[model samples]
Target: MSFAEEAWVPTTETECRIEGWSKETHQHGLQVRSSAEMNAQVVGILPAYVINFDSHNFGIEFQIIGSDRGWLKIRGAKDDPNRSKLPIRATYPGIGWIPGEQVAFMVQSGSGHQRPDAESAKLLDLKGDWLTSMGKIVRVVACSGEWVLLDYSLGRSRNPQTLALKRLTEAERRASQGRAWFRGVCAIQETSCETSWP
Candidate 1:
């Protein structure tokens, strides 16, 4: 079920710094499954070689691509069941998060408005090098049993909604200190994917 995969790594200096992912890190031979479909089987499991912990939110920025449904659920913790899960629909490319609240993104819903578990939402107090680290993640749940974790990092130009908003240009924005939001998981390859906000 697993589909194509990618990764974000150091690149030559350029006007715009971008990242690319490839299967060189891990083999997508395994079927990609959604959090709902895989049940207990997919306990936030990740492959090796994806290192360079960010110490921020604790986990690597794992981007899952192919999926049958348009929606995906981001849980607070990998193993925690039925916790706070965010919805990432096509309308919102990158979903923002409040430091403490675990903003999990999803594409669709079954019944009433889907709400993440209250306990799962909380600010991540990551003591790291990058002071300005924000993100909006887009992911997909595929029928192949493999999922897509797209980590779209945001500029560290202050909280757009707050006075911290620095109003820096794309260049200045990229210059500001930034860090990935992931710490690494032991039992499985814990990943912290992201997307950008409007």
Candidate 2:
């Protein structure tokens, strides 16, 4: 079945209310009024993948089951054996709700196109400092707004860096057009890298 036809399953653990508190009051040694109040309770913390974006710890990864406005309902992965085995449609335990800005999609392998003619792409900071003179081809791992998370080797080790979408030159932009990952991300936000600033 196609992805659109598949049913969404909730796999994450979330905070839920199981029971409420009750209070009773007595006047003149007789029960005058008994009141029951609801209390908010928290479930155990769910396991989540860490998103390394500018060393920020606010980012997390979860299975997106639903979305409303700018919030997303995310649950843990179904394949995780450590997670609780629950029914997919059960809503007794809710999932997490985070802002849309904290979530990014992963670029699967073989989904990216190649530009053999493009030898290397330049890396520049927001202030225009050339981070790499001869940067290797990197894959787009995740994207948020106008920034894309790239995995590239600086010297001997590989590292991830967040780059502005407009940093690429005209030629570089043309070269990256063949990449499926870039195209998918560009469809979300309109950004051009053809500027001649640096």
Candidate 3:
């Protein structure tokens, strides 16, 4: 279907993030179906693995490219810093279809300003002078289908804007198993990092 023909909606507007299905819900892992229906061909599997959220090296992130009938087609972030280093082939250029129920859309009320804590993130190209230059260091607050809510700090002002995901660099890709061991170990514990947040 054409991009214009598809009915794409953001999973969450407040936070702008989408989460994969948890292991508790699907023990075998999240399957990437060829179509939105249950009988569709199984294209791949996004394994269900747990990570230490308290650690700096949390997990890989995916960008929603398209959606239909409660199914989302996602791909790895293009400018992910760890993409080239990941061992899994599915992650570096990961792309597949997953059920809508398998994903969690996060929404935050208010401005919901989160301290810039992500190790690294790149701004997607907005093709407009009003937006920050493509690939500029940005603090990604949340992401939905096609758009990412980013915080661009220039001097004293913090500009929070939503831009297309295609414009950003892929900083990291999600592995089939949802485990990214290449991020290395977090030198500081969660408690120590908490003190650093503003």
Report the number of the highest-TM-score candidate.
Answer: 3
Which one is best on lDDT?
3
- Candidate 1 off by > 4 Å: 1-5, 8-133, 138-148, 157-168, 172-198
Candidate 2 residues lying further than 4 Å off, grouped into runs, are: 1-60, 77-94, 107-198
The clash tally of candidate 2 reads 1
For model 3, the stretches where C-alpha displacement exceeds 4 angstroms are 1-27, 51-60, 77-93, 110-198
Instruction: Work out the TM-score per prediction.
Output: 0.20, 0.23, 0.35
lDDT of each: 0.25, 0.28, 0.35
Number of clashes found in candidate 3: 13
What lDDT does model 2 reach?
0.28
Q: Kindly report which residue pairs in candidate 2 clash with one another.
A: 12-76
Residues 3-109, model 2: lDDT tens digits: 43222222432222111100111111111111111122332233333223444321122344443333344455222222222223212133444433434432212
| Models sorted by TM-score, best on top | 3, 2, 1
